[model samples]
Target: MGDFIDVEQLYDLAMTYSVKLLQALLLLIIGLIIIKRLTSFLRKRFERRKLDPSVRSFLLPGISLSLKILLGISIATMLGAEMTSFVAIIGSIGFAVGLALQGSLANFAGGLLILVLKPYKVGDYIETKDHSGTVNEIQIFYTTLDTPDNKRVIIPNKELSNSSLINYSINKTRRVDFKFGISYDDDIKLVKDILNNIVSSHSLIIQEPEPKIVIGEHGDNAIIFYVRVWCKREDYWTIFYELQERVKLDFDQNNINIPYPQMDVHVSNS
Candidate 1:
């Protein structure tokens, strides 16, 4: 009789645990389906917001993982696991891992900030203090750039987020600045007229702002004229080089002397 009672008790315990395991399995499957649908729904909404591909790639997985973790906790509780102890263990593991990869975590956060805020996007021509290039790819930990000379440069995303960069391609039009210095003896009016003519003749230059031509400074060797012209961003380099060449040629024809640095010394016999 004692043996039979022990067997019956063991059988009841086994059946109870089996039922809980089945319930846990069912919950896991249902939770996964819900997570999938939710992820899909969010992706479509992100597309409507026109979020960058990098941002979506980083965010979707994070969201899915977080949801699955919560589902796991729920399933574990259903399976008779103590919630407090389980959460505490997970927290301890996470804290240790975070400490081990602190720098990586910081960079990861920086990349996320960059992707969401968009100070500069891929395809933008950006200039940093030590680097200038066209952005080719923006990733979670780093970014790739193709320089004007066709060199590929990889930069840490943390640096990009922390530093100030100039995005030349962000605007449709950009102002090209030029400083031309001529001998103080040259006719200021003639120089101004020549600059105005050159700027007006350029087909790429925009007219709404009107070119600025004015005497800027009187230096030891020359008088400077500060010239500014607005042009389409695509035409900026072309207009810049063309204007310099035209100015030099026109100045030569008009006998305007572009001054160079010189030293004047008086020799004394003492």
Candidate 2:
């Protein structure tokens, strides 16, 4: 050995390691704070400008996460680690992770499609093969739904996108279709007049379509009529239920017979 260990060299080594550790810690903390602030700022700016909630909710988290990841790698490089191999190492590890999380990646892709295509939005009453409910939240991996009976449903985004979605609440107005059957003996014109009056006088019905009540079909037992009315979306269910009740009451009061199928049987005696 050329010489014994010196206190000065040990002191310098300790000082160097301390400085590196401190720098790494400081850079990490600062980078995280900056990422947080930037994301918060972006979200507020979008919200203040009245941007769509879906856009804001999706973009902010993504931008923040990406920035933090990049900043962390930069800090790691500054702490005396060779970033060339580090980058390749991280890339390979990320590739393996991506393979492991294939389903999650697919869900994320589905979420992007949902956001872009806008098949449905929060609070929209949607029906799909997987489930039917009012959408409460649209997240990266899943979409949350609340059913009519107050049940919470969480469906994977991939499944939702793969199926047909019926978004009932997307528009401001909706048409309500109702069918009624009357005895063939009943006057068609009289039935039409009663139905028109009942539909037009309803509080929720819109007058623009003019409340159509038309003869639909002639069945064995009864003549069918179709009643269609347009109303605001919020009033759909209420108007639907009220119309059924009101129409029945009106038909009963006017002695209009609603016929049902009946058969007379004769037994042959031999």
Stretches of model 1 off by over 4 angstroms after superposition:
1-91, 264-270
Candidate 2 similarity to native, TM-score: 0.83
lDDT of model 2 at residue 100?
Answer: 100
Model 1 has an lDDT value of 0.90
Which 10 consecutive positions of candidate 1 have the poorest summed lDDT?
52-61
Each model's Cα RMSD:
5.9, 3.2
Question: What pairs collide in candidate 2?
Answer: none
Task: Name model 2 segments beyond 4 Å from true.
Answer: 1-15, 260-270
Q: What TM-score does model 1 achieve against the real structure? A: 0.69
Instruction: For each candidate, give its TM-score against the true structure.
Output: 0.69, 0.83
